[model samples]
Target: MHNACLFLGAGCNAIHRMSTLARPACLGLLACLLAAPGCYKVPVTGRAAVNMVSDEAVIKVSQEAFADFKKRYPVTRNRAYDQRVQRIGERLAKVAFWDVPAAEWEFVVLEAPDQINAFAMAGGKVGVFTGLFKIVHNDDQLASVLAHEIAHVAAKHVNERLSQAMAIQGGGLIVSGVMSTTGAGALTSNAVLEAYGLSTGIGATGFDRKKEKEADHIGLIYMARAGYNPEEAPKVIENLEQANAGRAMPPALLSTHPSYPERILQMIDLMPKALEIYRQSSQKQAPQLVK
Candidate 1:
């Protein structure tokens, strides 16, 4: 009887000690699992994605981020380049052909001569840097890059990525609760969370590579439908490959994207379908190109 009392008392004492973080941790875990990300199908590819963020919230966040970016780097006012990009972008925008209702898509030309990158924001904001003209060659290649950037959003990669991060964080909290119950010290428990966090960060690259391949597959179709040759995609890849060749490279898995050859092969494999879309678009092309 005395031993049972002693054990019960000790158990109660341990629970009291853990109450600070452990109780809240348990509640946090319950809330996380109950409020798990909802799955939605992306526009063209139909890949089911788990994302907790609402469309309204996503757009709001994107708008804020975009505004900050523009403040840091103003849009170019060069009339000729702006008109040319707007022309091609408008055409490409018209033939985007995604199931998702397009956001009021906006295009901007950024006059950063040293910046060779282009990006698509989640809410359909796209920026193409002036330096890209050095290798883009013409409208078709530019279309290829734009299509690829928009495909990233069409595929819901950003939302899915956010979901992954939330899951990792939730998992860490759950584990912390378990550790607290096991009488782990704060330092030891924090160390475990840190280790798991490092692992989570590294694992994120895997999905990025998958999203890249998915974007490449859809981008080709988008550009083809916009009346550009699907073959132009491979040319862009070749340019990227040549540019990256001299630079030191990371291994395939650790890299955020596939190697140029891997990406080129993926585009090549999709060429037949993309080519058919191109032919159909060409048949329906304006009798005279848009002025």
Candidate 2:
């Protein structure tokens, strides 16, 4: 079954299981309902998806969770890191703006040199851990990281994910109600944060492989369009692989993402197109060394 089908398995399967003779009728009814709304094409890859949740709901939860994170963690004081993140983030945000017009973009560098991860919540709440600097060596490489996070927002992966959970658990109203409040409550906050690739007390909870790869595809184009070197995207994966060489488990960035080799090959396959975009970009900027 297609991924979207899996999310609707409960309803669709019931129609399939009720009776063989009723299959066609049930399927027709279900299809009509599903196709009526919540259907969309992903921006870069153009994959068809179903996102049943409202953007306002997702963004509300995102802002609340981001606020919670801010309360729990200290923002970095590194002026250099701050300036670099702000610069690269702004460029990527401009290129990604149309995809997420409702976004209220904010880039934050948190003081966590031990956590090598970053995430972008829907509505443009982004956070980068200080530890990610250990692997990212240049402005372009940093762009690769930031662009990937932004791609998540541009693609509406979080909204789709929330919709999936609501469908599976049959809690659309419950979840929406929680999201319609000031704090978003713990349940809604945790779900939204996890979908955005973080867990409240547990650190990073990565998205599925397909979403991560989609982010890579979209991010590559975004960085290229922003005049950042697209080649550094593959290099970013290589660096992460190298950094994980002796680790017991994958880092947060690679935890549920496509394998490094797989991601590198996919990025290489997409490189020619990305290069063309970079060549045509108008906002060329010199690569600044991160160290």
Candidate 3:
């Protein structure tokens, strides 16, 4: 006599009435069904993932959100910041297109000197805050930031996230609900924006730990391939730590990204391979000042 749930056939009473032992079995069945047809490999790292969301749908939402962001934030007036971001972003884009073939790459610097953040959306829209320049001293360091954001897009982590949300929330219909709205609902417009690593409507949530680490790995390789010194990759993390030394926040376990120390160690472990790519790259260029 229980009514069906929002999307699934079985209703609230039925779900609520299920025996504790039965709930696990039901969830397991749902997981199997979601996984059966959505298996795919992450770009660059080749890690397996189950993503049921479509690229077209995710990109559609992303483009709309990016347009909205432009309207809300004033673009930077600093010619130097704009030029440096564009220069390095374009260079990274050239090397990144193999993974994100549909990218309509656009790099922007938004005038937010108090916010040290940068993000890349699914459709290749990227924005960096002016405060980031405080941490990024050189073009190579900036590339580490840009490349990491780009890696998030090229790896389709947004789609992967939406897919995970849909799977956990019961059905694919959740995506429609999330994408159909224009305002501040947890799963509405904020879903895509949050997935892209922006701390919008909601407080301060970024990508999950795994996705953040993967972006770091992929970004290190990307910057090195694009002829930026990968050694500077870890320096960016160091700068961030020093900058935030007095700020109060959650512990590493509760944070979206790995601890800065862990990130530096990982980059060090990844350095030899990244260095090899850098040594062989024909596109090597001298580091340019960002400030």
Candidate 4:
């Protein structure tokens, strides 16, 4: 009986190994078939990316996930504050398209007073915490945050990151199809992985210092084009530093974003160009406002 049991266990292990090896080939074939012809161009950077998922699908998922988020957390009902955020967000959204185009933009402010975070999901869903509002003192400063987040969406950073994660983790086809059919489920899956930093572990890391720098650079341009002062960009970082001082940094920011000093330096390096853009935009707006 012992020998018979040992033989059965060996057979099971062999079958498991065979199944694991077969999985990748199946995913590879699916990835190849799903690979369409058109390419996506990132805004501001103008860098080309492969269009794996449709924009409509991405938007659908974003909206669903955003709705879920709102239900899970409290949404602020400060009509005045909400309207103000909407105004600034709309302005930045216009500038966001200088590199992309015609994004279906939406912004919401959550009532989470303890969560000092903000994110722009795959489509145009942007969320801000009331906690973040405590740090932003003015419209220009708010523009800085909005532009940075919008940069992520305009670049389709979330989609790119997810695709890379799927490919490396052997879930490429499943993840892509899931993202299309059930946007909320895909985001929920991602949320779990994000909580444990699994994406970073699999070398499908999220934004690094380089990506953050790119966002700062591109975001400065967006804010400037939207008629906000580019100088407000660095100010936003300073505010974050002050707000987070002596407290443990949020895991989400630490894992996915650049350190404050690095971001500040990048902002300083781009200041000259950003200042020039700011001046040009100011001149254009001055004439229009005078009319």
Candidate 5:
């Protein structure tokens, strides 16, 4: 009986060692399969992002979320207001699309009037609140907001945040299951969603300061290229500061994004380069008609 027990114990140890050695190899294989080709690169910054989710996947998930968002919030039906947003959005999107093709762009103005807020989701979904519209005031201001949001998309900021979250959270069978079933969008768990201020009815959370600064810098260029006044970028920050005064600070700019004061200063510094782009675009004449 003692001899038989010793043999069985040895067999179990051998199996355990084999399993331990195989685990990492299996994980490496899975990672390779999951990894996607690098297609999208951030303009100006030249950072590369993995194109894990296809344009079709982004659009599919965004449309789903957008439909659900509309059901919860009222959409602005004013023809004049909608037309103005569309005009500015189209011009900005044209510049943005130059970097990211297959963008199924659509802009909607939501009739919410609590405080200034705006968001852009994957698949080119953009939402602007009426409260924000009041702050935007004119075409230049509106372009500033649109350009910033477009920068977020162009940089794939959302996906980057999601990837970071997954890394912190442990990878295992559950993550694999979620990825297979839901695509990259599912990686944005509720915690991340709230953090990014993507949730409705909840005061939106802000992003880290670095991301905010990056967005601001890239946004200025996008607006300038699209024929909007880049000088208006700093003005938009000033307006937001005034709009948020007295109201509970939405979130620390540094906490959710770079502090407003610092961002304003940076914009002021970048104004010259942005202005140069604007000037060049303006001086270029429309194509001459054939004689």
Candidate 6:
């Protein structure tokens, strides 16, 4: 009886010690399931995507960030530029919203003449910098950019990216918590996080070629559906080649986006299909220059 009492006491003592490590590990495991349940298939490509974050949640996050952005970065006062974006956005929205509707859509041209970039977010938030006009030889190219950005949103890339981030963070927190109790384990956990650079905040998006190529394929369809020549898609990459030159490079393995040459070649392969769509669309118009 005395030996059994001693064994029970030892078991209780071990449980007390393990309780501290077990809770965070369990929470981290729970976090994995949080976003994993929210899977949705993409529209055009029929690709399956897991977006642990709900559309409402993603839209809320996007609007909050966009609001913060507008406050810090003044929007352009160029009426012509603004009108151009709105016109294109309206046309694209009519089609894209059918793919993935948002509660509202707003297109803003920010006053960054030297900043040649653009992005589209959930809830139909889009920004095109004036600097991008330098690369805009014609409306087709602009359509390519807009369609590509729209493709990203329609594919729910932001939500997928965020959910991926949450899963990683939860995993890290759980690992860190479990390992935190021991000197060697803590060192190992910190090393793992540092190696991958998974800090508490969102990290570099690490845009992969698969996503970029998928966007290219869908964007070609979108521009064609919007009455733009899908052939102009490659021309956009030629422009990107010019714009991205003299830009910084990460190690070849870690580049967030596909190399410009690679994207151009892939677009070439997709042109035939996009052209068919363009030829069939009733709204086809002569390519218009945005200058």
Taking all chains together, each candidate's TM-score versus the true structure is: 0.71, 0.83, 0.83, 0.71, 0.74, 0.75
What lDDT score belongs to each candidate, Candidate 1 first?
Answer: 0.62, 0.78, 0.78, 0.64, 0.66, 0.66
lDDT of 5 by residue, 59-93 (tens): 56556766777676788887777787898899889
Mind giving the per-residue lDDT tens digits that candidate 6 earns over 1-291? Answer: 232223344543443455542433333334344333454678789876655444665566566666656665689988988887888777777777778865488899988888787877677878888898888788788888898888888887755555444434443322222222223222222222222222233543434556778888788889888888888888877887778789876764466577777788888888888888889888777777765
Residue 73 error, candidate 4, Å: 2.1
Candidate 1 Cα errors over 4 Å, as ranges: 1-37, 171-207, 282-291
**Cα distance off (Å), candidate 3, residue 239:** 0.5
Better of 1 and 2 by TM-score: 2
Model 5, residue 55: displacement in angstroms? 5.8
Kindly list the per-residue Cα lDDT of model 1 for residues 170-234, writing each as its tens digit.
43322222222222122222222222221233332333676788888888888888888878889
For model 1, the run of ten residues with the poorest summed lDDT: 189-198
lDDT of 3 at 37: 52
Ranking by lDDT: 2, 3, 6, 5, 4, 1
RMSD of 2: 6.2
Q: For model 4, name the residue pairs that clash.
A: none
The residue pairs in collision within model 2 are: none
Candidate 2 lDDT at 40 equals 69
